[model samples]
Target: MEMSIKSDAVPASDKGFYKLSWTQRIGFGSGDLAQNLIYQTISMYLLFFYTNVYGLDPGVAAIMFLIVRIVDVIWDPLVGTFVDKHDPKLGKYRAYLILGGVPLTGFAILCFWNGFSGSLLYAYITYVGLSMCYTLVNVPYGALNASLTRDTNEITILTSVRMFMANVGGLAVGMGLPIVVKLFDPSETSDLSSSDSAWFITMTIYGLVGLALLIFCFTQCRERVVMDKSETENVKVSDLWLEFVRNKPLRILAFFFITAFAMMAIGNSAGAYYINYNLSGTAGELSIFMGLGSIPAFIFMPMIPAIKRKVGKKGMFYIFLITAIIGMAMLYVISMVDSLKEHMMLVYIAQFVKSTGVIVATGYMWALVPEVISYGEYTHGRRISGIVNALTGIFYKAGMALGGVVPGLVLAFVDFNKDAAQQTPFAQQGILWLVAVIPAILLLLAMFIISKYDLDDERIDQINKEIEMKHNNQ
Candidate 1:
């Protein structure tokens, strides 16, 4: 308690809370940027790598995806519990920025490797290892947000900085990967020699870049408002469950994470398939389509503070999510129509429109975690960041798993072929739905579920005041 407080007078550090050092902010933002390079690469490109480059049957690949998600159900909680329990000497949560993050980079590149000839063993090994390593990094990183500060405004600024960096990474992958891949794929020869080389080369670049960001993240970030010193005993599994059961905002947020990410993962993974077979575009065109999905973030994310201020967080969500649904529906209609303009041009517009809504809406959901953590602290007099983060971690990973499993299964049901230069008409249609309609429906469901979220400006401010009083009273 003495160390936490220099005096009864608020320190200049606390007064200038809204302004974190460039290094601290970039260091924090870099972690998510690192994650996007690895995670976003997988989300955007894994299915294509699996079916075309890795040589897995679409049906088998889908089953593998489902199995992986099922395994995640076990792994996410364990990572959460482990992160909550351990207090590494190097740094509490940031240690994983190096430890877990380094391995994550290696495994991510390997997942793109074409060796092993589509062996079920290969897909299971690299993908599962990558998922586990991601947990080690992700759970801690989620906890790190709560660790940074107790100030609501600081958290909002931090979240904004983080999302902006994340979108920058997203823009790179969405725009850059295909062009890079094309540099390798140069010819239309029906063999994956080019695709394989492209993926290996592209992933290597992203992975190395991510590794550098991890180093920066480790250097810059620090935990300020941690509750670790007050611990009577290590955080236990039961405590994790108890937090979810007792905290209303945590429960709402956890479910929200799952649905929202699942929607994102599903559409992103389907990009190569849908564009290749439906409009049947070149790698260059595919690059444009993916790039369009992320371009709006730069245009619109800066407006988030204003948007939240004007409409309220919950109100902003309702408006944007419904707008996104309209975009998705229009894209789906475009998919079904016979006499549309250049299909790529139409889809690029739809992606741009849909992304405008999806990027801002889901991106803001991240800032809610700290708010809920405050609510938990006010209610229980404990600030267990890891336990709280783990619950959110589970839903986020669950959504990703669903994203993988659903599109894989659907493509399998439609009988997608990786070996062929082209897809069956039915399979192409399925790919269209996988990218456009299925995700649209999921986004709609996400909106419905989020409508139940009760956390608002009034509740968040009250919780913050209560927690501030607790610290002051001590």
Candidate 2:
């Protein structure tokens, strides 16, 4: 598609800066790799860790997840504002790779430490600190996307690389967990009940790997499209509250991100329970489940740019949502059927299909943020990528909160006997619902919300042109 963006507004030099060198591309992708080890580790395993290792009841852990997100609601905007207001000597957003990343990594390692058995205070404190430190890095990294040039194609490519790495990291965490645990102790029945030695050792290694990635990502990433040194740093707290009211695209995208990530989080978090108790699968089954989750990103995510071009973003959402819904229905039905009860492969296949739709839909959404930030710049004349990212970060965390809370509440409500070797039938049904049905509903909600997303290609091209014109005139 031809773009009519005012060329004069974008300096000839800025166009070159839009695309990254191969080294830069690899460097940028590493952040997600790091985040996967840290953030995904927490999201996927924290509740399991709590119930199985830390000995917190599912109900209490659920409350703790909710509380952390509530804490995020307070920190997100403030961090966004802080980054936007200050001109760090190291860099705008990239510097946080070290500044915030070190603490973030340390706390992540500590979160898995089993020193304080049954200590809710330890769980709450470490998890909260890890989350806050993560926000300091994440909000800035997200803003870093907008600080790059306004080339939609380049941004799309960059987003693709970022998402690809994120999924790869996700794959490692999901699939690697069983492998990692097995390496430590091949015969442990439930990871929760395994020798505490195995769990602590496993997490320590993951924690160390996460720290290395954080450093690599920080060193590699640089903000290309920075602000004028003369630009005023004054940012009123009221401005962040106002940004939501005035920024319509951010509003739509933020809500879409929330619902979409929540769907994935909720579904992924519940899958282990469904497989273990509902399907009567062994630890070997985890490799298959984790594989299903990761493989689709490779299969489907690469097609996102092409798919977006062919069907338009809104049309693509509808198709994928339906695909996910069907897959989820099959998952629930297969698990419930008496004859099919032992055939876990059918459920795995359904999960594979459901994840194909979800991985693409959710992964591609990260590509859309730069567009919204561009729109914000065009409308408001301030290029505040950090603020925009923080808003979205708040929603993403909210999505994670749902993922964490829903399954916990479900398990708690069912009075899950985690201490038992085998779950009751009622508990098994609860696992099915948590794994398939609840997330399917969340996905449906996301699809409905995305239908209201009005950022068409033509409109975005226009916004870029206007932004360019503004820069030229300045």
Candidate 3:
């Protein structure tokens, strides 16, 4: 379906907002879906694979995770600046989808390969390579969102569709991966541990599929909103921080990204452990539990526009953030009580509630990035989409770093034993903290940070309009 607002006097760009066809929206969304298939798999299961299949120490893996993100802190902004400073012949933002996607796919597959099993150097090389390649795709893709159109409603719908498809990728990873790995290596039925060949084959399949999706996204996206070549002539890495310093809403949103992604990272990374150790679940059950984290997205994401309309953005945030905390509390409580823990239905219900909140709240935050980008353009007269996205990417990776580091550190602290049939009660308790207590605490902090966001819809619309009018006059 295509949506159009006809006005004889105005150019499409002069209108300050453009509506996308369904194909464009879905095509762009496929990029995210692809990333989730590749990266989300890493986020959720790589640590588990490292410890169980690849023989890396939990504490050592945690430090490697930290160092990888530190490298991102330096690399992301350079990618951003380079993107903003030049327009490629292929396409400004969309070009990187293929350029980066190819290497990203290769590195993702390599991350799971246990050829150098237990080799920390190989782990660091593959993991760091994958992380850098990811930023190469991620930063520009974020810029692509802002460049698509300035229409607030369009961006909202785009985000919804993007997240919906992303969860599709998440679901594939969560539900299908374990089952597929087991299909390949049925002899080792207990869990993913020591199933090295299965992990490699699974990642190879996902990586190729992800690369294909990136190609489809590249063909469909056409950058319509962007800074003029003259305006972007002097784009610099330092501008990312300068924008952060000046753009209050960006700062707030940046912090919110940190908390929200961290909350998700910690929970997602711990989910396999939570199910396998704490619940004494089977591989199938582990798939179901991890899959539930994304399942709510299919049900609740389409309602985001309505929810935001009725409650307003911040109101919606407050409602869902609190709901997530409640669900986490239920999870924590259930695991502590034997009777409650015995009923899988109750655990599934708690996961649904918690995921419903987390999915909707975090899914909608992507829309706000465009708003902040517009705010920067209004004030600075330069729509530095790449720089803004780089800034957000840095913080988002920081959250992911915490996700990667915290689980390993906590597992190390609790004396997690890969060879043991079952984890100690203390280790079980720590896993529970990763799944529930820690994420809930972060959601509370996210609520506080998001409350600081001052650019409501009305204000952002006006800013976009003024910026467009200025462009038209020039």
Best by lDDT: 3
Q: Candidate 2's residue-wise lDDT over 1-474, tens digit each?
A: 234343554554464236677677777878877888777778777788788778899999999999999999999999998888888888888888789988997898888888998899999999999999999989988887777666777677777788888888888888887678777864566432355666678778887887788788877776777666555366645667777888898899999989987888888788667766776676678767876887787777667788889998888888888888888998888887878767777877888888788877887788788888877777877777778888999999999999899989999888798778789888888888877888888888888888888888778866776666566556
Can you write out model 3's per-residue Cα lDDT over 190-277, one digit (the tens) per residue?
A: 7654578888999999999999999999998989898889888999989998999999999999999999999999999998889888
Lowest-lDDT window of 10 residues in candidate 2?
Answer: 1-10
Candidate 1 residue lDDT tens string, 229-346: 5471566777878999899888888888998999899989988777777776766777788888778887777778888889888889988888788878778888888677265677
Task: Give lDDT per model, in order.
Answer: 0.80, 0.80, 0.91
Q: Which residue pairs in model 3 clash with each other?
A: none
**Model 2 ranges off by over 4 Å:** 1-11, 15-17, 190-193
Whole-model lDDT, candidate 2? Answer: 0.80
Local error of candidate 2 at residue 56 (angstroms)? 0.5
TM-score for each predicted model, relative to the true structure: 0.94, 0.95, 0.98
User: Given candidate 1, what's the lDDT at residue 82?
Assistant: 75
| Candidate 3 Cα deviation (angstroms), residue 459 | 0.9
The CA-based lDDT of model 1 is what? 0.80
